[model samples]
Target: MTWLVTGGAGYIGSHVVRAFEDVGLDVVVIDDLSSGHREFVPGAVPFVHGDLLDTGLVEGTIREHGVTGVVHVAGFKYAGVSVSRPLHTYEQNVTATVSLLRAMAANDVDKLVFSSSAAVYGTPRTDLVTEDSPVAPESPYGESKLVGEWLLRDMQRAAGLQYTALRYFNVVGSGTPELCDTSPHNLFPLVISALVEGRTPTINGDDYDTPDGTCVRDYVHVSDLAVSHVAAARRLAAGEPLAPVYNLGSGTGLSVREIMDAMVRGTGIDFQPEVRARRPGDPDRIVASGGLAAQDLDWAMRHTVDQMVRSAWEARRASRD
Candidate 1:
């Protein structure tokens, strides 16, 4: 079955598109290019440069491409910035999702794989989050994502929409040199860009109660995350059952200090990260159990911390040249 991948020109979306191709599945792309690069999409793939807000364009693309499934990845993804730009975030994430769902229903595209976020958990009381963990989204971005999932559930009851939302934590590294993370607010890009420019990467806080006195997070390689997305799509296409949500996490986590060390080793840059005061609402640690995903979606942490850093550095460096 053919799939329409929204935001397919973005870093993670590009990788997910490639994964679908690697599995010999027919795929098409729909991206607005606001935060995506047209160059990331292959020359051969049919690309529709448009936004999900335009319901007609979205429905037309699905019908023209014979898309039976959709990988919904396009949205406002910045969590910290969403606090200030709540309306913009809701418009992009929540409203866009509703529009896309309407288009899918109108076109009889019943299958979907939603790219959700671990932000829905906010600052979980427990370190290891499970699929059943309470969802208390702290930012507009997260809240929008939760609403997107709700819409899918409601659609399932109303229109027989078969869907699965993969909640991801800190996604980093690169699947290819042509597609590297360009998010201004992501930690890896921020740190790597600083080092590339001969500046010290500053840690947000160093006095947390973690092993290295810094916040701990689940950092997964982009390629690994993409694999799970494809698996989810395949399961849905094959008419197999899937959980409502799955956490694509590392189970364990790494501290910021640990990542800094990996970056030093990966880039051969000998420097200490400058420690700064904790950002407001920063959690000490947030990791999740990927056991459910591992069973159904073929989820696994295939890259080590060093590998993650090295791949990301290579791609970032190549982008500069």
Candidate 2:
């Protein structure tokens, strides 16, 4: 059965596409290349360079390829930028999802795996977050994602659609050097890029309540996250009962200082990180528990912090060359 992977040429989406390939599942991709690189998609996989807002295109691709399911990874994911560009974020992340849901229903493709984000939790009061955590999204991007999940829930009732949303924390690392995270807003790439460019990495606000005076966050390897996506898609395709949402995260998290240290070890960069004023909306910590995902989706942290940093560093270095 063929599955359509929306935005499959992006960083994490590329890894998800590879995961499905590794399992011998045929797949197709439709990405506008807004933030995704067209070259990241394998030549053998059919690639449609288009946005999800075009319901007709989505439906056409699904019908042409005989798509049986979808792994929805396309969206506007910059939480900070979404604050100033709320409408764009909602249109990309929310309106497009409505179009996708409509296309799926028309094609009778009832199964889906949604790529959700930890931002949906906003600044959680609890040290460890779960699927049941309150969703008080602080940015338009997050609000849009939460809304996407709601659409899936309602679609389930309206059309008997089966779906699952994986709300993962900071996705890092690379399955291969060609598939590194290229987001300018992501922390791993920012640090690795700084060191590569002969600049000292900076840490914002060291006076946070967390130990080590830095924000703590769960960082899951991108490859491991992809595995869970594939598992969720498989479960949905099989009509197995699944939760509407699952957190793909490391229950325990790393402080900003710890991540900086890992970068030092990973890249052999010796300069001390510059401490700066904390950015607005920065929280002391936001770590989600992946207990539920582990039980159902075969989710696990297959790589260590050092492995994560080293792989990302290597991949970023490779891209520059």
Q: Top model by lDDT, which number? A: 1
lDDT of 1 at 65: 87
Q: Number of clashes in every candidate structure?
A: 0, 0
Top TM-score hit:
1
Tens-digit lDDT track for model 2 on 47-161?
Answer: 9999899999999999999999999999999999999999999999999999999999998999999999999999998999988889999989999999999999999999999
lDDT of each: 0.95, 0.93
Please provide, for model 1 over 191-259, each residue's C-alpha lDDT reduced to its tens digit, 9 standing for 90 to 100.
Answer: 999998889999998889898899999999999999999999999999999999999999999999999
Worst 10 residues of 2 by lDDT: 192-201
- Local error of candidate 2 at residue 118 (angstroms): 1.2
Residue 19's lDDT in candidate 2: 97
- Least well predicted 10-residue stretch by lDDT in candidate 1: 174-183
